[model samples]
Target: MNTDSTRRWLALGALAVAMLTIGLDVTVLTVALPTLAVDLHANTAALQWFSSAYTLALAAMMLPAGALGDRYGRKKFLLAALLLFGVASLACAFATSAGQLVAARVVLGIAAAAMMPLSMAVLPSLFPEPAARQRALTIWITSTAIGLPLGPIVGGWLLRNFWWGSVFLINVPMVIIGALAVLALVPESRSAQRFRVDVAGVVLSALGMLGLTYGFIRFGEYGWGNGLAWVAVAAGVLLLGAFVLWQRRTAHPLVDLGLFQSTGFRWGTALSIVVNFAMFGMFFTVPQYFQAVLGVDALGSGLRLLPLIGGLIIGSRVVDKALPKLGTRAMLAIGFALLAGALALGALTTVDSGYGYTALWTTVLGAGMGLAMPTAMGLAMGELTAERSGSGSALIQALRQAGGTIGVAVLGTVLATQYRSELGTLNRDPISDGVNAGVSVAHQLGDSAMLHQVQTAFVGGMAAMLWVCAALCAAAAVLAAVLIRAPRAAVGEQQERLDDAPHVGQGADASESTHVS
Candidate 1:
């Protein structure tokens, strides 16, 4: 390879490593949550906050982070984000209490908010060829794919051998390596246009996401009876509505609302949310089940999750090979259908179900996710130009983060409710809190009957959550089938138009319109 070619691949390597650290951090906490609860004396709300806090910060700042990257420099912002992520990870490692850990997670999320979008935004400029870009995206996405599975395994080993904080500490080395690689290899790029920042839009969008996400989390803790949840939900809705109105009216909006006009961008964005909702929800529940219901150790739980990781890799390869002939709609619909079917099958689990049974369905679920997520993302981001890429990528990722946040909150509530109701005669402090607490309590008391009851109740809750996931996946499949257009030669045509369009100062005066592609 030539020097330029080598640099591009090296930059990709750095970007992939950066992306992997973020993805790993998200799921690594799952295997460690039980240990955290015991070590930190945390309640269910605190445990939820551990995950929700990170995702919330990520969702809230994504748009603004994108805009900043566009204005300043993508590489500069990414490097800073990586450094912040490293520092935050160290803080998380040393956190002595639940509150401290949650605070650290917020910082980590802000850093990730910048890193994820900026990393993706750089790809189009590095590889202008469609085929090369697709290959790069696959590598980029696969980093996330690898991290999800590796999280439990790596975290499990650390939890078994070292302190519970070891998971966060592990990120330190990866960040150092990534930072060095990025500094040496990646070229700085930014938007050609210097548009005014939409301050109102940023504030409104951040608060709106915060309220909506917090409302759902509060619902899990206090149920529908809480007036605070309702009010927060209402306020969030109003703010989001106003934000949209402001974006339409503003001269230089934070996000280009017109991107929604593209059928690919619209449905593709929706489908991305749907898949993550199902995926993150499942990740939140299963680790708990392995430890609480099946009596597996952290390491064992991680090992059992291997089938899921394997399936995701295999499924993505399948889709990549088939995309040329089957096109976007057919492949995405098929992938979603597989996901729905797998999760629907998973809902049939009983207390007696073993790893063999769980693994079968989880593998299929992973495959379906691998197939759908990257394809949907491609469709959403395919239409964006170099100048608009940062904000556009951020919007797509912002919705994804929102979906994951809501999914965890909503599904976690379902699991908790069903578990509490099924607690039967074992209504007590720890038992009412969560399955993990109940299992710990039962073991301490040497109460085999209570243990059995806790296991059975948790299974019942998991079944209910899986059923809900199945329904959502089914709906997404139908939407993709009906809405996503076939893959087209539109990118080349659009690029030509952009080239021919008028330019005034930094901004292009082209229509920036998109046809179905």
Candidate 2:
């Protein structure tokens, strides 16, 4: 490879490292939740906040982060985000209470919001060739996936041998390395024209997302009888509706509503939500099942998740080869089919089901997500121009984050409700509240019958949640079948247009160097 080519690929490596740290932060807490409950005296609500806080902040800030990067420079903003993430992780590692940890997670989320979208948006600028960009994107997506499995393994080991806080500390070194590499290698890029940041849109989007996410999370804790939950949901829906109207009317909107005109972008975004909803929802339950029900240690639970990770990695590798032949619609249909099938299989799991049963279904779930997510994301991003890449990428990612947040909230509510209902006359005041609490209570009481009841109820709840996911996946499959389009066949023509397109900040050399494929 030429020197210029080598530098670009190296730049991609830096971006991937940064992406991995954020991704690892997402699921790392799943395995650590039990440990947190024991050490920090975290209740069910606190546990939910640990994950939801980060995702909610991420979803809320993504639009602003992307716009900032577009208005300023992607590299500089990314560097600052990395620094903030490192510091926040340090704070999280040393948190004394559940509230402190949740607060730190919010800071980490804000920092990550800046990093995630900007790193992705910078890709088209770095690897202007379509083929190179595809390869880079695959690596980028794979780096994020690598963290999902690694989070369990690493967090498991840390929780087993060290303190629960080690999980957050692990991110520090990764952040430092990512920052240095990015500073040395990645090129700066941004829109030449300064677009006014829509402060009203940002406020509306953030409040709407926070309201909806907090409402569902609260519903899981307090049930639907709580009027506050419904009020928040209703207010969120109204605010989001207002946000859409405002964006449509604004002269310089935070998001380019016109991007939805592309059929690929529309369905791709919808499918992305479906994939994350199922994926995140499943991740929420698996650790609890392994630790609380099966009596496994953290490390053992992490190892049990290996098959799912393996399937994800293998599926990501296979999609590129399959996409050309299968076309977008066919690949998406097959992917969602696997997803629905996997979730249906998961729903059949019993309290006494072995690890092999869980592994089989989770592996299938992973494969389905691995295939669907990247393909849909590629389609959504494929037609976006370089100038609008930051806002565009942020929109895609923001919705995906929102989907994950809502997934956790909705599925958690389902699980909690079903578990309580299945308990049937059992005293569940504080001891038998959630799966973890019920398990702890049964162990303390030394009642094998009570233990059995708790496990059975928890399993029933899990099964109910999986069934809901399966139904959603089935719907996503139908949508993908009807809406997703094939890859655009005219690569050469697209490249020619890109070359001729006016670039304000960059020179002719920058445009000339960029190849469409």
Candidate 3:
């Protein structure tokens, strides 16, 4: 037993637990959204912000945080992130007003942005061998995945038995545990390079992400023709373009623009964007479908989602075994194909589709996600050096997050568009009466049947949306094929010793010993 590698394992276990708390927070709060909405008397926009704001902040800050982690020390940044995350969570528990809660959530988001990337960033420093590194990442990925489906299951139980704030409170202990363990076990590592922090890059990226997210969100409610939505979209495009241009001219760019020049990294990044587009799209609608349509309470909805969760767990394990054999390109293709079919099957979804049917399709979609997501991530992470991992991982996660948000914006738009179309055909003015027909249907017809129409329209939208997901995944497959260079035995034999790693319902690795089949 090598003394150094063993310590990395112990340190990582602790860090995984700490990071898992943030991962769980993403999905855990999702199930509690309805409860928060009712108890706080918040409207739909507030509810959307309740979830979206955290993602927005996380996406915005991740690259900067990653860079900061490298320049400073990953371990040091990780500990600080845990502390801030814990403190913010406590504030969230006590929030009285919607404004206060949303603000706290944004703060929490910033803290989370720090945690998500740095945790994985420190991993390579721990186990220098591929075998152990892949194993460590598996555990790390598994811990985060464990928190997801359990969020609603656990949050619902807590909400049913206690209060909605109970969810945030649970994070308190996890943070304490994470901070203490990191102090005891994790050693600090960062880039030896003296890279300047790209403030302009940071600002432009933030503005662009927020603008696009806001534009999509506003469009969901106001329609494609809305002036404000178009403004948001245009502003987002221009700002993001400016950010890219600035990066090229800068001496120390926030992200190495050259990384994308690598076809492997570029394709891997695209793979990440597409997978999240599908998974996070599910995150937005799954809860509503189960609660509003399936006529289930939060817990029931979470439980019904077991199929997808179960599939993910199994797929994660399966992919780990397969990666050495299938290679990243093949695994991604297989994964995306399964998921695309699941989305198509979702087109047949009905109000009374039954959990069996729902479970079947979700499982298929999830299995594909479990397979494709990690393989691509491994490729992306592998492309970076240890010093760059913090920034690189953050870039991957941040862009992936942005993709998830865009997924919700786009898919939610589809659902809303379909819903409004259906309503227009009905010639109904229920909404004009200051009544939510969707809400009223929930009470009178049982949320199940009413939810079916919503689900049907949603699935119909998603069916088409799923094709986009498939094409993206397929495109990623081709990109991986044409662009991704296999490690030359001479150059990469040692490095391959580590290339290999998955989930966060709210959010959120590579290997050589085994080919990613």
Best by lDDT: 1
lDDT (0-100) at residue 170 of candidate 2? Answer: 93
Clashing pairs in 2: 130-516
Go through the candidates in order and give each one's C-alpha lDDT: 0.83, 0.81, 0.72
Model 3 worst lDDT run, 10 consecutive residues? 504-513
Off by over 4 Å in 2: 30-52, 95-102, 430-432, 487-517
lDDT of 2 by residue, 1-517 (tens): 9998888888888888888887788778887888899899999789988987887788778888998887788888999999999999999999999999999999999999999998998888887766567667777887887788678888878887899889999999989988998888888888765667888988988888778777776776677788998998899889989999999898767777777776766777888888887887788788889998889977787788888888888778788677666666777888889999999999999987888899999899888977887777776777567776788889988888767766777798888888889998775676457888888888999999988888899899999999999999999888888765444442343354356544537533322311122
> Tens-digit lDDT track for model 1 on 122-172?
887787665567667777887887788788889988987899889999999
Off by over 4 Å in 3: 1-3, 38-45, 422-424, 427-436, 442-464, 467-471, 474-517
Q: RMSD to the native, candidate 3? A: 6.0
TM-score of each: 0.90, 0.90, 0.86
lDDT at position 24, candidate 2: 83
Residues 1-517, candidate 3: write the lDDT tens digits.
6776666677887887876787688788876787888888899889888877787788778888998997788889989999999999998998898888899999999999999899988877776665455556666766776577678888888888889889999999989988888888887887766567788888998888778777876766666788988998899889989988997898777777777766556777788787777776666666666665566777888888778877887888888787776666567667777766776676566656777887898898778877877776766666666646788888888788767766776776666555556543332555222113555654676655454454455445444555555566566556555655652221253264233321111111221111122
In order of listing, the candidates' clash counts read 0, 1, 22
**Reference-based lDDT, residue 452, model 1:** 92
Cα shift from native, residue 427, model 3 (Å)? 5.3
Query: Model 1 reaches what TM-score against the true structure?
Result: 0.90
